[model samples]
Target: MLTQLTISNFAIVKQLELDWRNGMTTITGETGAGKSIAIDALGLCLGDRAVTNVVRPNTKKADLSATFDIKKNKPANTWLSQHDLEGDDECILRRVISSEGRSKAYINGSPVPLTQLKELGRLLINIHGQHDHQLIVKASEQRRLLDNYAKHQNLIDDVSYYAKKWAELTNELERLQTSQAQREAEQQLLQYQVKELDEFSICEGEFETLENDYKKFSNSQSILEDTLTTLELACDNEQFNILDSLRQCVDRLIQYSDIDGDLANVSTIYQDALIQLEDASNDLRHFHERLELDPQQFQVIEERYSNAINLARKHQVSPESLHIKHQELLQALANISGDDSRQEQIFVELDKTKIDYLEAAKRLSDSRSKAAGEISQLITSSIQELNMPHGQFKAHVSTKEGEQLSSHGLDDITFLVSINPGQALEAMHKVASGGELSRISLAMQVILADKVTSPALIFDEVDVGISGPTASMVGDKLKQLAKTTQVICVTHLPQVACKGHQQYFVAKLTDGEHTETTVTELSEQARVKEIARLLAGDKISEHSLANASELLAS
Candidate 1:
């Protein structure tokens, strides 16, 4: 339900803030009092196309915003959750249109696209104006209304799931059918590549180890010469050898050990150094013996390294990535091997899914067909009470070989009506009088009241062509709907406005030379004055006030 609306610099409405209550709220004022502007502002907030002309002539921008209570609207909350928005019970939607043809939309102060605003609008309010009355006549729209009325959540879910699967299968079939030559060429190339790779029998890490060995073997001669020279100077050379010098120093230190306590420690260090040099010399001699040069081994190493490098370059990958490419080619080969079986499986599954989905859809259609009869009877009874004694209303459900199924079903549903006796029933849009359409709209709402999820239903002059007893009944019907859902209406009829739990009056006023529009919620006394004015003229006569008071009391 809409809790509040604030409009600024929009057409004739300079600034207006309306606090709306739950249940039926009626807005009434004189003609040209900017009532349409108020509705237009609501439409703009609901993502209607914006025009700079709708803004006040001298203003930079026009702003329209409203707050809605979604405590009872679970569908809207789920939609919000899907969009990654916090689903508070209260939601505020705001829109601003600039004179420069720029518009901004926001939900709960966070900026959003107009598309999102429109999506949220569908869940929040359903405004049935003249255009909407015409929409009721369309068969597709009728089907949607019936589905909504029936609250077929499971059927809707199943149809959507199957429709997506059907679409995917159709796309896959097209790809496979149309790309046959290209796929064959790709398969041929992949087969040749896989055969070449399989003959190699390559192992992971082998390339890196081979390269390391090649580097060591290539530098072995230079390495051996350097290490041997160092070892000779350190131990093998007779006079200048460090190990010989260390032995002489140890001999002198042992003699001085009796004179100094630390001399023995120095002698032990020299002895350890001599032992380490001897072990190093022995290891260097073994390394020199092992460093034999082999041209054949070097050639083998280089040839293997070149093959790895050439393959890496040919494939536009590092030698390390050869393994991954090998696996990918093998997987592609497997896919090609199972291509026929996969296609057959998809075809079989597609047929089975279509059958399953059609069964569910048929079940839904059968239920709707039964419900349609009941709906026709219910609406006819409701409309007859509204003074359309000769009115004939019917729900026509037709099934054809549809091109595709929709979220609703494969069948088409339309509302048929005949205004006069002996007249053949036609589509609902063909109805001429505004009064009849309002009655029909009311009848549909009455029948669908239980299944529609909108917390608030707003009627913008839906009672336009109705008057007298019919107007009073429309008001009563709106009041009845208010028990389950909030109902708001804009009307010129005092009877319609009188039935509201809350009443608002939009009036044009002049502040100095400027003209603006203002809306005020009427108190009981104020309502009497307003209703009396609506009954009579600008002057509220005593009799009119009495009549108004009587109407309110009743």
Candidate 2:
């Protein structure tokens, strides 16, 4: 429910604030008095396009805001919570347009994108302007309305889900079939590569170890000669052997040890040196005995090292990464082989999904067919009461042949009507005049009032081209709709204004230099005079006043 609306410097509305209540609230004024300014302001707050010209001539910007009570509106409350914009029990939507043509939107005082504001606005209010009558001409809009009336939202969702799944599977199968021959040739190449890699069976760190062994085998003779030379210098040579000289020096130092403490220290040092030289000679002799050159082992080590380097280059990878590359190739091969099997499985699933989609669509179509009859009867009865006594209304639901599955199912729905006895029923847009279309729209809304979840409905000029008894009937229908939800109507008919539980009068005020539009909530006497003015065209006579009173009384 819209609880309040505020407009500042918007068009001719200098500053205005109006409090609203549930039930029918009628707005009336003379022509050019800006009766529709309130509706326009509401549109601005509901994310309508803003223009600089809408700002008051002397003002730099226009501010518009609307407050909605959503404590009982589950869909609106859910939307607020989902978008992280939930406030107390009320939601405030605000929009501001600067003279430079820039605009900003806010929800609950927090800035939001324009699209978010529009989405939430749709859930909170339904404004049925005179132009909305043209929407009946669209086939898609017709489908939407029929589905909404039938409450087939869940079925519609299922059809959408399955349709998307079917498209995905079909595309995958097509792609696989297109590349079947190329994949077969690639599979043979992968097999040969796998076999060759398995033959080498390379282990981590094997390349480095092979290179080390090859180095040792190729330099065996040089290693043996070097070790033997080192041994002769340390202890193996017969002349001037280091170990023998050190032993003789130690014996000479021991003879003087009793006479001199320094000589005893020197003898200990020489003895330690002789022992180290003897150990070094023994190690060299052992190394020389082990250094035997084997040509066959050398040849094997060289061949393995060369093979590793060449293969690493061939695969465009370092020797250390060869193992990882092998695993990657194996995975690629497995995926290519798996595609054929996966394609067959997808075909099976695609068939099942198509069946599911068709079954769901059929159920929806049946429900629509049943609902068409009931809706047509209800609307036909409603329009007759609105003064179209000879009118015939039908909800035409027909199956679309050879149509691919879609989110809206397979039914093409259109509303057909005829306002005379001899005329055949034709599409509502082609057959109904502007006035008849308004009445027809009103009838449909009256029948579907309970089904609509929007908390507020605004009817702008729905009584256009309608007057006399038919105008009164339109007023009564709007009043009936207000019983379940808030109804705000901008009307020029005295009968409709008299039917309102509350009445507001819009008028233009001028201060010589400027003109501004103002709204006044009418008291009993004020409402009577306004209604009289509507009836008498700016000259309220005694008869008009009395008529207004009687209309209000009724």
User: Relative to the unseen true structure, what is the Cα RMSD of model 1?
Assistant: 4.5
Clashing pairs in 2: none
Question: How far is each candidate from the true structure, as Cα RMSD in Å?
Answer: 4.5, 7.3
Candidate 2 C-alpha lDDT tens digits along 366-445: 99998898889988998999899999999999986343667677788989999999999999888899888888877876
Model 2 lDDT, full chain set: 0.88
Q: What is the number of backbone collisions in each predicted candidate, taken in the order shown?
A: 0, 0
List ranges where model 1 is wrong by over 4 Å: 1-17, 36-130, 238-289, 402-408, 431-435, 510-515, 536-554
Point out the worst 10-residue segment of candidate 1 by lDDT: 130-139
Query: Which model scores highest in lDDT?
Result: 2
